[model samples]
Target: MPLVAPTTIQKVSGESQVEVPDLLAVEEPLEIRLGFGPTSNRQQKSVSVTMRTPGNDEELAMGFLFTEGIIHQPADIVSCRHCVQDAQKEGNVLRVELHPDVIVDWSRLERNTFTSSSCGLCGKATIEAVRALTPGPLASEFAVDAAILHSLAERVREAQLAFAYTGGIHAAALFDANGKLVLVREDIGRHNALDKLIGAAFWQNWLPMGQFGVFLSGRIGMELVQKSWMAGVPLLAAVGAPSSLAVQMAQEAQMTLAGFVRNERFNLYSEPARVRLAQMV
Candidate 1:
């Protein structure tokens, strides 16, 4: 499946309208199926169905599983592949095989399985639910200069190839303490983008990403904070404002949360100590 599709649209400007060719970010539904249980008694069930761009299905699946507390590490996954039961469902269905030793709590998944790419983990009722899966407060001394943090948004913008073409994609990027771009993932859904980024790191066995920072191309929501915290990322910066719950969660986790990061300025909502400023404001 192509990440972008060509379409003809009406270009209107001050009563002037013309049909022109344009590019659009592709969005498709990806059904994530889990195959777990003892080898003698294997079980397969559709865990989630999210509308997302077609690329990075495996990463998205793995990341989703990890964030949702289904699988802890990459080793827990035996394999992730497209399950093409029918030609029509070739790229839309993905089956993840977990090690037989991996114990699955199906009841938990059933309660959160129906998710959209836009709204992640929709049925989550309380912050404590997330806290149960998240680790303790981040105690790492990892910090970055304020000036370096200011440049992270531009770095993500430069690397957002899909956003450049469609102007409708969201991005999540991982950066080192020096503000160097490590990797980026783009999707129509912001949550999916972050999942893809986390999944990539998970595949590399980079769980508990305490040494790096995560940058979002949009507002920081509670779910985003939860995902970052699950990955053990200490710092999360975003181009837009954050929700009240997001700040609360970040503060509780001792994670640095920066929002509205642009124009040489940003708001540090929590763990300000992790960001060094030349002169305190």
Candidate 2:
């Protein structure tokens, strides 16, 4: 199905009234389900029902599981497929089959399809209660030029085919250490976009994404930082402000966070060392 829909809106600025065709990003509900045990004895359970833009559905599901701390390794997923229902309903449900040995920690989960600030525990208490679910302090040696960081927003913008048409959608992209964009995903939901990007990596056996940087087309929030950190991304840059908790989470995870990346100016919130500025030789 097409990711956008056509709508007519009346333009009434002064005395003139004209109907104009406009494009709107399609938002729909996606049900994510989990199946465990051997194929002969598996049981399926509904996990999340998220409203998102359709495209890269499989990648979005995988990324959601990984970022939510539900699945740690690519090998943990035996296979993923859309539900067996009809076309209209088929694309709306995603089922991920897990290996028999992988035990899903249902009690420790604090999963969501949106939002990025709190991981069940909020503020200082988050450090104690939820940090165990995330990866340890990053040891990635990936670094990029500050100039490169400053230009990342445009790089992401040029590749945003969906945002270009709908303007109402959000985007998340993965860039290699050389400042080249490697993967891009767009959705009406910001977190969904991030999930699709990481999920693509998961399907391609590209976990431990410390070698790549993530760029967002919108504001940096606690959840985006948390998801990127969980995916092992060493650096994250966004076009808007980062929440206090997002900055705190990034610093605590030893990940570099940059915000307001546009017009040749950007702010570094944590792990500034990863952004190298050239020195006069």
RMSD, one per candidate, in order: 3.4, 2.5
Q: How far is candidate 1 from the true structure (C-alpha RMSD, Å)?
A: 3.4
Q: TM-scores, in order shown? A: 0.93, 0.92
**Cα lDDT tens digits for candidate 2, 111-207:** 3433445544556576544477675888899999988888888888888887888899998989987889899999999989999999999888888
**Quick one: best TM-score, which candidate?**
1
141: Cα error in model 2, Å = 1.5
Question: What is the lDDT, from 0 to 100, of the residue 56 in candidate 1?
Answer: 93
Candidate 2, superposed: residue stretches over 4 Å from native: 86-88, 111-121
Q: Report the CA-based lDDT of candidate 2 relative to the real structure.
A: 0.86
Q: Tens digits of per-residue lDDT for model 1 on 212-276?
A: 99999999888898899889999999999998778877888899999999999999999999999
Error of 2 at 31 (Å): 0.2
